[model samples]
Target: MLISLSRVIKGYLLSALLGVVIGSLIGMSRTINELLLPMITVIRQIPMIAWIPLIILWCGIGEESKVVIIVLAAFFPILVNAESGIAQTPESFLEVARLYKLGWWKTFSKVYLPHAIPQILVGLKLGLGVSWMAVVASELIAATSGIGYRMSNARSLMRPDIVIVCMLVIGIVGILMDKAIGIIFELFTPWVEKKRRD
Candidate 1:
């Protein structure tokens, strides 16, 4: 569990950072959107499972391979949602920024980023869920440690009870992580919470 959690956390953080930065660029710059959107769409269409063998070949079925797979599994939803959220920022808001003579960085901080936070959080939640699944799946296929490996080992020993226990633990842990993220985001974006309450 610790091994898997570490990989998931590393992959999740990297993916989130890349997703937000790249998504913001794609959303804000028409040239970037035109250049990258088609390629991203094509890559996104190819399922992650199909890439596993190639990834293992490239990364040698080690921690690197597992982390790479988790990153792939989590990156797209985050990128899409962040792009959508930033691009959906109101034109009127931009006008306000311009009226105040705000520069690009200031406008982004004051208008675009704030508008996109909620959607970005939604993407992060989705990414984290998929990341958990990805780590487990990759570990099952190729790993010496982790909850998945423990389950696989138990299967060979005919310990069905351990497998069942692992499954239950996975589900519980995933739910807890999801709820924790939601709570943290609600704290960071209090307006979002107020809107939900209303």
Candidate 2:
């Protein structure tokens, strides 16, 4: 369980960071977005589990394969949401930044980032969920240790109680991770909460 949780956390964080950066760049560049969108759409249409066989062949039935699967599963929703968030930045905000003669970095940090926070958080939440699912699936197929592996072993022995226990652990851990992200989101975007109240 701990091993699986670690994989999910690490994969989720890295994928979220990469997705946001790449998505922001693409969102800010119409030509790049247009060039990449079709390919991205095609890749996203492929189910995460479907990649398992190829990932195993490429990475072996090891921790690396599980992590790779988790990362891939977590990446796409984040990329899509981050791109949409940046693209949806208000024109008024851009106009104000231009009027202030803000540099690109300043404009992005002050205007674009704040405007995109909610959507980014939404993406992160979705990514985290997918990461959990991916890690479990990967573990069931390939791992030597993890909640999924334990459950699989229990199934062979017909130990339904152990399987149930593993399921509960996964569920609890997932809820904790999600709540932790929610707390961080609220902490970073207090102004959004305040505005909502007003």
Candidate 3:
């Protein structure tokens, strides 16, 4: 279980970091969005399972492949949400920044980034939910360690009990992770939550 959790965390962090950076770029720049969005859309159309064969071929069903699969699974949700949040920054806010004679960096920091924080948190939650699924799927397909591997091994040995235990554990852990993200959202974007009461 610990092994699986560690691997998932590693992959999730990598995907989140990359997704935020690239998504920010795309959201902030029309040229970058035009260049990347179509290709990204096309790739997103492909199902996760469909990539398994090619991934196995390239990454050879090892730890690398598992992490890659998790990254792929988690990336789009985060990237899309981040882009939406940043790109949808109100023109009024931009105008205010302009009136204040704020530089581009200051404008983004003071205007766009704060507006996007809630959306970014939402994306992170979604990404984390899928990360667990991706790690399990990838591990089931090919892994010598982790809870998924243990479950697969148990199944081969006809141990339904072990399989059930693994599923329950995964569920519990996933819920805990989701709660953690919620706490982060509350801590980081308390104003957004407060606005809900109005």
All candidates: TM-score: 0.95, 0.96, 0.94
Report the poorest 10 consecutive residues by lDDT, candidate 3.
Answer: 47-56
The 0-to-1 C-alpha lDDT of every candidate, in the order given, reads 0.91, 0.89, 0.90
- Residues 93-170 of candidate 3 have per-residue lDDT tens digits of 989999999997898788988899888888999999889989898888888899989999999999999999999999
Q: Candidate 2 lDDT, tens digit per residue, 112-188?
A: 88888888888999999899899989988887998889988999999999999988888888899899999988898
Number of clashes found in candidate 2: 0
> How many backbone overlaps does candidate 1 show?
0
Off by over 4 Å in 1: none
lDDT at 14, model 3: 96
| lDDT: worst 10-residue window of model 2 | 21-30
What's the true lDDT of residue 156 in model 3?
98
Best-performing candidate as measured by lDDT = 1
Candidate 1, residues 100-146, lDDT tens digits: the string is 99998998888999899999998999999989888888888888999
lDDT of 3 at 168: 98
